[model samples]
Target: MKRISTLIAVATLALAGSSFAADRPVHLRGEVTAVGAGDFVVTDRKGTKTTIKLPEQAQVLDVSRSSQAAIQENSYLGIAAAPAPQGKVRAMGVMVFPEAARGLNEGHFPWDLGDRGTMTNATVAKVVKKASATELEMRFGGKAQQVVLDKDTVYGQFVPGKRELIVVGAKVLVIGASAADGATAANAVMVGRDGFLPPI
Candidate 1:
């Protein structure tokens, strides 16, 4: 009876330990409302505010302006566009995902760009520039879509951002762990340069 009791006690302790395991890192996107000594507050699109703590060596990435020339065949991309006439999508913005982010969010779904906007993550099969806008033929999962782009369309690529770039009124997408004090301790923070948001 004592042996059985000992085994049960060990199993119980293991289960209790599992309950305190840290949560998986998640992404948080919002506009910075405040910046403190080692932390900042951001308000998301839904108006929810979250406090995020930055470690001394927190990784920071800056999203800078890019051009269609940067996009090449077989490049993974995420496009936010609105439906155009004849079943086409007119691109409002394009985000070039790095090779490491390939296959992330790999599908087309409704987005929040226009009245009935859509977001597509795919590989660029072809790119043709017209007199006014550039057209991209993108394919993913054996499906295809035509995305139209123009100079007004924002393009963003991530680069290492200096810590000083973290400031009030800046938009950020942070990947990190949630702390017990209701703040997120960031592993990496991506911010837009020159007032643009990180599209990916």
Candidate 2:
């Protein structure tokens, strides 16, 4: 009876922890203001400061400055966009994936950016430059999507990075889980290098 009670108590604690982590998902984009032992502070564009805890196993990716010229035919990309006219999407930001990271999360799904924001991870089939915008025809999971990138679109490329990249004044995009007490813990952190901001 004692062993059974102990097993039940452990199981309940595990379930509670999982539920707490799942209850709140955090996505933050901002500039790092301070880095401390196992935690950091970020201030968003609107000056909202948030403290984020970094776990020992948190994944980090470095984003480097990129331009439209880097987006070529057959290139893989992760694009954050919103629906536009005639069944197309307007690119808000584009992330050029490295060749080794091709086909990562290849799908089109709803995003958290805005009311109608979506994220598409696909391979470029064709590219066309117009007077005011660059158009890309992309394919993923047997579906096609048209994305238009205008002058305001941001671009970056992903590269391997270490925890040392997290420093003051560096731009970052973090995906984390929030506990019931409102404490945020990072699951992944993307840091921009050389003054480049993470585009998405």
Candidate 3:
């Protein structure tokens, strides 16, 4: 899969744009402070409080349990991994973004997971398991990222999130369009199950 280079097709948060496009995709990451009938409150990384209005038709998904064995060639993945020598990346956790969310945040960028860590949105070009760990060749656009998944690497998958997952203090990422009502009008929301941060 080719990487979606634009932020609207990749990652975004509280970005400014035209408000007239009802289906314009915006991205947000924050902590859930409240949940009500049709909306939830989020305080972004910058400590700015924003209301995220969820439409009844919105898709809500949770990060469910998964395994490293699920890693395969052609898989679209969001990897929050550590940095290694020679510009390699070491995987601590891997989230297999579903086909529907493929190219949602496509590119290699710095993430807050670790001090020197990075996030890569790409398709698996190859996967090889060695005696000690698994090596992955992930390609995005014209570039490639090398990732090593050790035995202790954790796995996460997107699953349908029950209403209970939207409760207080959950970390979330919302993809939506601007609304005249000030609150972001979301098309989809991904809430991390338990205390897991939405790594994408």
* TM-scores for candidates 1 onward, in order: 0.64, 0.86, 0.62
**lDDT for each residue of candidate 2 in 117-165, tens digit (9 for 90 to 100):** 8888889999998998889999988999999999889888765567899
**Candidate that scores best on TM-score:** 2
Per residue, candidate 3 scores C-alpha lDDT tens digits across 43-151 of 8889988788877766667766578878789988888788887878998778886666666657787665668767788899999889988899999888999999887
RMSD of each: 12.3, 9.5, 6.1
Residues 1-200, candidate 1: write the lDDT tens digits: 32333222221111211323664444677898999999888889999988888988566776777877889889888787888877889888787766665665567877655688788888999988789888889998889998888767877776456778889988887766775655577766778887777764
**In candidate 2, which residue ranges exceed 4 Å CA deviation?**
1-21
Ranking by lDDT: 2, 3, 1
- Model 2 residue 34 CA deviation in Å: 1.4
| Model 1: CA > 4 A from native | 1-31, 37-39, 43-60, 160-165, 173-189
Q: Judging by lDDT, tell me the better candidate of 1 and 2.
A: 2
Q: Highest lDDT: which candidate?
A: 2
Which pairs in model 2 have colliding backbones?
none
| True lDDT of residue 54, candidate 2 | 96
